[model samples]
Target: MSGLLGNHFITQIGILVNDIEKTSKAYSEFFGVPQPEAFLTDTLDKAQTEYNGEPSVARAKLAFFDMGSLQLELIEPDEHPSTWRNYLNEHGEGPHHIAFVIEGMKEKIELLDRKGFSLQQKGEYEGGRYAYIDTFKDLKVLVELLENDKK
Candidate 1:
């Protein structure tokens, strides 16, 4: 079911937690994955540049743990309205979504639309584009597409 969707690389998995440092430490100490590189909301000038040429304007604590070619971005928002916080506040956390690596995002979105999938939201990240879809909602899950791998 994943082959035609392009290479389903597990580029990232978001684990929305109430505490980032504690979670990072647990992963680093137990699984040997490097504790996430902390990013502050104030230092997202570059992120701002990539996201919208002005940033998404956020304040949160984040860390990344590397596992093979994939990374897990652990986020803890200091405020409300963020999807991560909303997820925990509403649904509790587990595996938020599996990000697939794709090239032509808009086209893929169109394709999904033709396939009867609905878009939840779409955004630009530090190195790629991402969109959340409702295909798996019946199964209580989300399918995410991320454009990365430019080097």
Candidate 2:
């Protein structure tokens, strides 16, 4: 995690879907597991959201499934202009981004910025913050950095 270019372990894989209920059920059936509960992002507190580094009201329906050490995240973008929405609009539903769990978000974001990876979207949850870095052009997928204070 010291440099911008290298092999980084992915902790989560995020997918953009049109319907979270349908997708979660389908994935649950496929994995022979119970369907995960979906959460609305807008309901979170102390949430500061941004799109393309500017303040924005981007919301989404999110669900997570634990798979051993890595987690799979499902995202259904709300009717707003956001990274997820733009991704859905441009490419339809599918894999959207891969994420890494970071400890120091500010330092990591600064490193990415210095490396020319712009912050596409960012938001703060109760005990953590998450950001999406613009990496689709080179990696064919957006990159995410998550910093959880609880962890």
Candidate 3:
């Protein structure tokens, strides 16, 4: 599994939270940093989100904090069948996924699929796209792949 993902550099950690406002505040107070603004995920037209191989309107409130070399992400999912919502329903609030910034999104997804790691949910953001792979059964945590547009 050494080269499963070209490199092992984790760029972000995502956590599912029932209350983004409260959680963000608590994290800010504890870390002595300002609470980051929370915003909803992009709409279907822009995000092109998919869940379980079907088009989905699942959205979430998100807040991000830059902590040293890694980013801490807080997610509060809407009442939709997304990876975020599913995990929260089954496991309550906790860590959801660890993400890596990678290139060759299509090839990486194909490689993971061949390795039995199915895609759970995927969507697009302003500058990039993200995919959540079903690696919990093996790795005990979901794996997210982020591929940003090259500038």
- For every candidate, C-alpha RMSD to the true structure in Å: 4.1, 1.9, 1.1
Between candidates 1 and 2, the one scoring higher on lDDT is: 2
- Residue clash pairs of candidate 2: none
Q: Give the TM-score of candidate 2.
A: 0.92
* Candidate 2 per-residue C-alpha lDDT over 69-122 given as tens digits, one digit per residue, 9 for 90 to 100: 899999999888999999999999999999987777877788888878888999
Off by over 4 Å in 1: 1-4, 41-60
Q: Is candidate 2 or candidate 3 better by lDDT?
A: 3
How does each model score on lDDT? 0.66, 0.88, 0.95
> Highest TM-score: which candidate?
3
**Ten-residue stretch with the least lDDT total in model 2:** 1-10
lDDT of 3 by residue, 30-122 (tens): 999989999999999999999999999999999999999999999999998999999999999999999998888889999999999999998
TM-score, structure 3 vs. true = 0.98
- State, as a TM-score between 0 and 1, how close model 1 is to the true structure: 0.72
Model 1 worst lDDT window (10 residues): 46-55
- Candidate 3's C-alpha lDDT? 0.95
Error of 2 at 10 (Å): 0.9
